[model samples]
Target: MANETMLQAFEWYLPADGHHWRRLQEEIPIFQKLGLTKVWLPPAFKGTGPNDVGYGVYDLFDLGEFDQNGTVLTKYGSKEDYLSLIQSLKEAGIMPLADVVLNHKASGDSKESFSVLRMDPANRQSPLSEPFEIEAWTAFTFPGRRDTYNDFKWHWYHFTGVDYDAKHDESGIYLILGDNKGWADQERIDNENGNFDYLMYDDLDFKHPEVVSHLKDWAKWFLDTSQAAGFRLDAVKHIDSEFMAEFIRYIRSDINPDFYVFGEYWKNDAAMTQDYLEQIDQSFSLVDVVLHMNFYDAGQKGSQFNLSAVLDGSLMQASPDLAVTFVDNHDSQRGQALESTVEEWFKPLAYALILLRQQGLPCIFYGDYYGISGDFAQQDFRELLDKLTFLRQHYVYGEQNDYFDHPNCIAWTCLGNEEHPDGLAVLLSNGDKGWKKINMGTLNQGKVFIDYLGNSTDEVTIGQDGWAEFPVEAGSVSAWVDRDSLVN
Candidate 1:
């Protein structure tokens, strides 16, 4: 059966008190209530000291035990907690996708890390330091600081919190100027050569045999023991494209062949995002944001573009199976001054756009579905998620689409195990408040039609154009319109 609406829980927001393991126990209820199909946990391994983001990793192993407070006792959580969480999610029929940070490791501007790596010259050029390498034009520091060639003598790059430096073993300093101190620490690495500059963030030296072995082992444990369904690779652009391809191949072949892998390419342009899709097993589904942006802009500007154009052209341009469609994520908020798609009525519309669309797997954010009032309060968010999960479970799961595009609307005609195509035809207003009449296209006239959320319906009148006019609250979406296909 087509599964229920796919939901992804953002790991960074998962409530944790001290460490990751402790928090995992506390977060089970939250995950269950959120109606998430998948729980995306932060990196479960040990990380550089005092960092909770989990990107600044220290060891691929070291999934530690929980503390007394029921929070993630360690940097994120322990292996036992991961096993428990995965089992819990499975019991609830939700899959677990481990967020893997394979790009780099903890080593930022700090004395302790250099001490850990055990580099020499303590203050100056550590025997392990390598010169930063990049194009001359690309400036390392934003406000035009002196080049490392002149200022320090070493070269490097940083991502999340991990640093990348060539010409050094595991024991070297990684120089990064801009980093979250809470998560990353910096150190000096020689940069007589300028190879690291052109690389995004810090491209880890994947050529090392040890680097390759470590990643393979990591994948083996996650797949063989924990039974993780997929992976969300962090910072793909920061790593060499070939490295990513090889990593994906390792996971797919060695691990479960059915396992899914999506990467964070982070390029805003669809074309740019597409460039990396060919390299990874499954690229991050980014088309929903594009559609959302188009609809949002049309609404705000009162333009002629509508949902149909988005479905027919823009969204299809990218491979749908690969795109991870979402309206708002960790970075984008609804109703923000920059790109506000978060209107009261439009919530369902956006969901429908994803779940009903015949493209990449549909994944919903935690807050958007349940209608969390704010970013805080786990209790409130859980309540909202439970209620909305019904729609996802009942209407979305196991539905196939015969057609998902529309001329003036976004249509996702879904069919369950049954043969007939039956689902929603969505119409969203571009900032207009008045009721707009819309044609049913190939839908039957006078068929019973209802808005799932509002629970209202009107009979289709044929001579008058087999349409109905309903008030469209501005900045919102009429996400679903239920009816059967019309007879030719």
Candidate 2:
């Protein structure tokens, strides 16, 4: 029953590391109480250094030291803490899914310092261990050099700051100048040679065979331990497509056959993200730039953050069965970007649409489950999660359904059983305020039940009209219908 709903808690249940073993011990019962079946912890493995975010892999074997200072000071904690957390989660029937970074690793700031040095692609000993001298290589040229993610574009524009020999490809790395002169092209680095090509983070060269092997080995170890359900692959698009495909295949062939793997492809449209999903058991469903822009405009640009008909339909077109849907994620929200932080009252509505919709595995962000930072202004988010999970089990997860959408609104209904005479319906309003009358094609009489904010269940008689009017609160949502109230 717990596995059916499959509630995955993001990050470790307690503060990561061994210090909170007792807290983890307490978490087992609490998670079970909350109907959660999985705990998705950030990479429990060893990180590069204090500043490393676990993705900057230093050693897969170093699980970290768990003293209080570990969580407070360093990104990783002690090995004992990780093992304990895994054990506890497993024993409580909650699977642990760790985030794995296979594409890149931590290296010395300078090309000379990196152990896996040498940019000559032919001379590289191991793709996984080898580092590149990216600082000297040319950075990606945007607009003109766009869409060359899989290939290399040396004509990058870094603001008129201290340029790194742009014309001199002798160093093997180039800079992509940006408006910020000093910070131009810092994120784009060489896959080999560890060139600081890109800004902020280091990018790895996935073309190397050694990098491929490292990813396979990581999958093997996790499956061998029988602790994790699968993995949430990070920065997948940055790596080669072939590498990702083979990695997914190896995990399935060598590890648990049913192991689940999802990638953070990060593109904004379903069309772009679809091919990546073909490589994994499941993936973030949609990644269209246009769709994301709409969300941005609606949510941030003095407009409502409502799902658009065009964007929703386009995403559904990608892969109805395998897409994992979400309202927002870590990268979606940034300074001056659309505020991904959702309104309290509107959360349930957004979730209700995804869970009740016909396509994609609905994924709820952490704050959506539990109100973050004591901003308990309104709504019981945790309780809403309980209801949402219950609905997923009874309706969304596996049921076949139909979708009806519009520019300002979207709604879906899934039939449970032929004899039931009732069904579950989920609806969302992207508009500011209005009452949308939906004619569900009049059917047999039954009470209509709506649980929008879970604040109250408004019941209306079907009558001969065979139609129900859904009142969508401004910037909010509602999920109800006469159909499957029996299950909840």
Best by TM-score: 2
lDDT of 1 by residue, 1-488 (tens): 44434555542454444444554556667656645566666666545443455665544444544221122344554567668877777777777887777766543232222211222324322334343432211112311222311222112322212233333433233443332211111111112232221222333445445456656766786577778888877766555666567777777777677776666554445554555455444434433445556545554444355544554334434677666666554444543323444443344555556654556666666556444444532222333334345444444533443332433333343433353334444444444443455554344345555554453344333223445543444444443445343221
What lDDT, from 0 to 1, does candidate 2 have?
Answer: 0.48
Q: Which regions of candidate 1 fall more than 4 Å away from where they truly are?
A: 11-15, 18-37, 49-51, 66-72, 75-77, 107-203, 280-317, 333-348, 369-422, 434-445, 455-473, 479-488
- Residue-wise C-alpha lDDT for candidate 2, range 254-318, written one tens digit per residue: 77677776666555555445544554435332233333344444554333444544345345445
How displaced is residue 118 in candidate 2, in Å?
14
| Candidate 1: Cα lDDT at 186 | 18
RMSD from true fold, candidate 2: 10.5
